[model samples]
Target: MTSRYLDYSGNMDGELRMPGKDKHFQNTEDRTDSGLDSLKDEDYNRIVSGVQNLCIPVSATPQDYEPEPWKVQNNEDGDTLLHLAVIHEAKDLAEEAIRRSYRDGYYLNRQNNLYQTPLHLAIITEQAEIAEKLLQAGCDPEIRDYRGNTALHIACQRGSLRGVGVIVQYSKFQLPSLLTCYNYDGHTCLHLASNNGYLAIVEHLISLGADINAQEPCNGRTALHMAVDKQNPDLMYLLLKHGADVNKVTYQGYSPCQLTWGRENSQIQQHLLSVTEKSLQYLPESEDEDSSDSESEHSDDEYMYDDCKLMCQGLN
Candidate 1:
């Protein structure tokens, strides 16, 4: 049998025995070079396990010990070390804290000065894996901070479909009701995604059975209207394919086709006009006529905050 030592720089030496193993082997080289043969043998695995079990980190003064903090959890910046860990790719320490939080139900909504969550930072920084892990750990996906926007909205605004997928996985139907989910700008996640040319996010929102034609207050802009404003022909094509009413008018009396026709997206304008005329070939009787009148507008602003508080208390 041969003795082995593991070093911080991943250097392995045969002469240096593992700590606590005072007995040295005479035939170190004869037992096969290095620990490869031992690794393949069960007896070697047991020896390695025993060595690991006996290992302990070197101690230091309280100030220097554990010098690396995982999160920047302070009132000034809402970011947690977990947020930065994911942002900067700090794996081991972040994983340890994440496991602890998972067990203790640590609801980390720490925002940096930006008032964003670890999840929000994940999306902004394009950390798809960390975002997924954080969501699974129960960081509220529907949570809104100072700007009154949810993680979904932030993902959409940044056009991070990868991040959006991580959020939508948790946010499908689970959420804190009060977030109105409508931001202070009076828009939904779908609205922001559609407005910002995030075709993939729009597709995901629609796949979740979101109202494709839902409008915002302050003049009633539909997804199609916002898509038109972005001059995105593909987005217009997507909205129309998803049953956007080309003839349906905004409060300003501008229909999708009208807005389309006025845009720089001449190809979209022509295509939308053609579709509007083609759809008029035959139409169904008014089923959602009255339903359309009562748009999904939230009259009470504080309702969302109150609902969020109630849900948080319940979870607590």
Candidate 2:
């Protein structure tokens, strides 16, 4: 009845050794005389039950297991699966993620490290259909990127007419507010479209009820003023045709016509002049008592503002 135990030392040889001793014993016991024979039947059954309880059954299908919540988010840029899908142009995967998130909707609006939601990336990447799907899935069109430009603003800036149309249509009750929402540079969708000379996008925004006369907060320049500054006669004409106030003046007291003074686009200048009030047609006199104010305004770059400089460069 001498007891022996399986050797668990560094050796691979399957020799039995007594506890507290270095000598090896031959494993000559009959199978029935092994360690299991020493345990009571109930003890053996209990050990078996414990092992069975600790075992986890393998899932029959991948769908049967849910992943950890953190796995859904990309570690690098905090982009979720939906964001990555849109970024890589994996439309089917994006659609699937969107479908699964329909009930939660929170993930639909989740922004990545750049504060850009999947919808923003969709429009920026020119995936109009995916943008629409995101909008339809309750993605908030109002969510802005780090630049404070909403998806709609990006759409207009990038001259994506379909992007603009889809965002406006899906915005439903929020369409009017969204059209007028300003980015960090104080440029609305209309201003971006107008500044970029996106005549079609400007027309589309105006048709959708964007405030044609909405003044950018930076210098109080309206879409009309921007069109004049860009010297885009077609855009100017479109703005005027859509009721853009030609008399609208910048914070510097220069009307759209005044902004046209040194520009070479005679057509825009003449059209603005024809419509602008006579008093606003002339630039503010440089020698007037308010000369210092006008001088200070001129010292700053007329078209450049904070992050807007980067945006303009990107658009170009």
Candidate 3:
């Protein structure tokens, strides 16, 4: 059998290789290849077996087992067995991958070519159960992907409320900080949820004390602003009910009602109007009484001026 070497870069080469490429592969003198021949047959077999376990498709039911030795093997993309299992939606294999990592103290938070961990893959694929598995294995949900979005951010954008719940429940991230975390584009999880009309997620986030009036850093648009722009009455109602300030303006100085002008969103317009009226009703009584007294005094002055002008006209 030909002897092959797996490089740290995930490239496999035969004994004959270019000089620089062969640096990862070693001769009997340097022994830099991590001593492939020194390992017992059982250890090598276990390593190969773990790789094969990860190769199992998601549709098939894989038996539960720990792949302690599979740590040595990874595909060309730097994706470990856990990353592959999550990508393939292989629930059983994914669970086993978590088990192996936990038992052997392996890194489950490793990033792939795209800078995505297994948890990121799970959220992208909308596989809530698989995400739960990764969380259970103590994968860091706060890891940002190449797009600068955490798994929780993806969950909100993808409308995976269950995944969000799993991440919040299992991950050690502070809820307030995570909720306020902005992506590269200055969008918080609440902004994504509102823009996508994920009402349930929005409600859940609000219940968890997510800032209903949280503004995007770049545009200064709040969740209420997003709800109005999307013309989603239900979202508007939900946001307003949660105390989203309808009168709050964006960087463009456009309030939620201002954004509704000339649009076809009558329901949202009416809702904003109603909320605004109710808010106005709560104005301080001192201010209202002062305005009323000023109005009456102005009326009396106008009447006296009119009487004096009539007498002057009659004399003339």
Model 1 lDDT at residue 145:
55
- TM-score per candidate: 0.59, 0.70, 0.63
Residue 195 in candidate 2 has what lDDT? 93
lDDT of each: 0.65, 0.77, 0.73
Candidate 3 is scored at a TM of 0.63
Question: Model 2 Cα RMSD, Å?
Answer: 18.2
What is the TM-score (0 to 1) of candidate 2? 0.70
Q: Which pairs clash in model 2? A: none
RMSD of 3: 20.2
**Candidate 3 lDDT score at position 209:** 83
Tens digits of per-residue lDDT for model 2, 204-284:
778888888998766788888877777788887787788878877777677889888767878877877787799988775
Superposition error at 231 for model 2 (Å): 0.7
Q: Who wins the TM-score comparison?
A: 2
Lowest lDDT sum, 10 consecutive residues, model 3, at 53-62
Q: Write the per-residue lDDT of candidate 1 for residues 1-316, one digit (tens) a residue.
A: 1334554334454333434555444333545366566464677667755655443333344454332344434443555667667667787766666766662224355566666777776777777887787777777776665677777778788888887777766765663342236776667788888888888878877877777877776557788878777788888888888888777666655677665532476787777767675543222234135434323322342465456545543443
lDDT of 3 by residue, 173-276 (tens): 56777888777667789899899999999999899888888876545779888887788999988888888887776664557776675569787787677666
